[model samples]
Target: MTRESSNPKPSPNDKIYGITNIKSYVPLLLDLDRLNYDSWKELFKTHYIGYKWLYGTLTQSVLQSILKPNATAADVWKTIEDLFHENKETEAMELDDELRSITIGDSTVMEYCTRIKSISDLLANIGSPVLERNLVIYAINGLSHKFTHVVTTIRHQKPFPTFLEMRSMLTLEERSMAKDHSRHVQASHQDNASSPTILTTEYQNRPSHYRLNNTRGRGGGRNQRGGSRGGQNGGRGGVR
Candidate 1:
């Protein structure tokens, strides 16, 4: 996508404390990728559509993480150059948090939470905000909710779901919710054709091999044979 001239760059007057200039942040960014996320760097290249976007996102996330709430654009850029010394992600409870703390941290999280909490004002925001918003939701839910909000939302899961899967899930959530809501409207309209037919089909005699006890977010559980779900989600597509 071509950069639009209408979109203004940060003004010098805007003081973003705690972040570094994109150029100065290069070494630290590379270090972040190598220290624990080396695999992601390669995967970013492998991803065809958003290679540059993912890299820029990594950069943007890193900038947002270190910046304080009151920081200006310059403050953010300046802080980035001097952010942290060692790999402090190991200190964070989840690997994604550790990375995001230095990568996309509280600022991004806060912004996203704000957006989700206020769906009405979303249109006033920028384009294609779902990815970031979904990420924020995932992070927040992971910290609080009872779903498999692991190191990150399943949407952002690296290997199995990939970035694409997250988008799909987000889309699916919207579609499912819309369809679910449509039932009420169909009742008001009294048009039988307006209502969607409910189909609860069961796969007859299906093998029980796929069943396991992976509750939403309470952690592992037993299988049909009552054995521990050793893999713990068994969906570890995370890029280490």
Candidate 2:
């Protein structure tokens, strides 16, 4: 009966004003334990400027806990923040314990250091970043006994090297140790090649043909000597 309003409300399907299929935009489901909060927050913040559309990205459990029919985006986001941020201290402690116990065991130096860096990154993500000095110390502590000398050298430096520098020094030291081991093995082989004891062992280990030929030669000599003695005895008997 009345004239239509000048500015009608935009439909939910309006291209610029509406968000369709939030799951397509933000694929990650928010978990209760907050392990993925940082990543989930970044994606959610990027896709939608509005908060109402966030419910679809949460797990059913998280959704039931945070959802209310009258709740606004800010309310839900604050609830999420409270749930995730409150446990940062506990998470940091657990991560610190993990970093402390990491070891180099059969892993190469690169792999060992990469593991330390990964844990450090996770700590940083949780707002409990490890200092560079402490990171280096953690890495050095985890090394196997073979790196003891390098570890001592690293600790003794006036200004401790960066983790990368320390890793480089250790890599070089490992190469040097390998080279020295190779040289020692070669020298041992040379020494064994020239040693009388080793040569005797080698002689005894020679093929059966070589031993058999030598034994045949010795047997011939003994037989010839016995024949000479028998001929001499025959001559003596004739003289008698």
Give the winner by lDDT. Answer: 2
Candidate 1, TM-score vs. the true structure?
Answer: 0.22
Q: TM-score of each candidate?
A: 0.22, 0.59
- Off by more than 4 A, model 1: 1-82, 90-159, 188-240
Off by over 4 Å in 2: 1-36, 49-87, 194-240
Best by TM-score: 2
Q: Candidate 2 lDDT, tens digit per residue, 1-240? A: 345577676764475356668877788888754456787888887665456577778888888877777777788889878877887899889999999888899988888888888888778767788989988898889888898999999999978899899989989988999999999999998876757887798888999999999999999999999999999999999999
lDDT of each: 0.40, 0.83
lDDT of 2: 0.83
Worst 10 residues of 1 by lDDT: 120-129
lDDT of 1 by residue, 1-240 (tens): 457777767764343332333324333243333232333334433321312332343555564566366655456434544443233433332334432333223333344334343331221121112345444544345332322334345645555454334444545554565686798887877755432343322333344553332242234322432343434445454433
How much is 59 displaced in model 2, in angstroms?
A: 12
Error of 1 at 28 (Å): 12
With candidate 1 superimposed using the best TM-score fit, by how many Å does residue 239's alpha carbon deviate from the native?
99
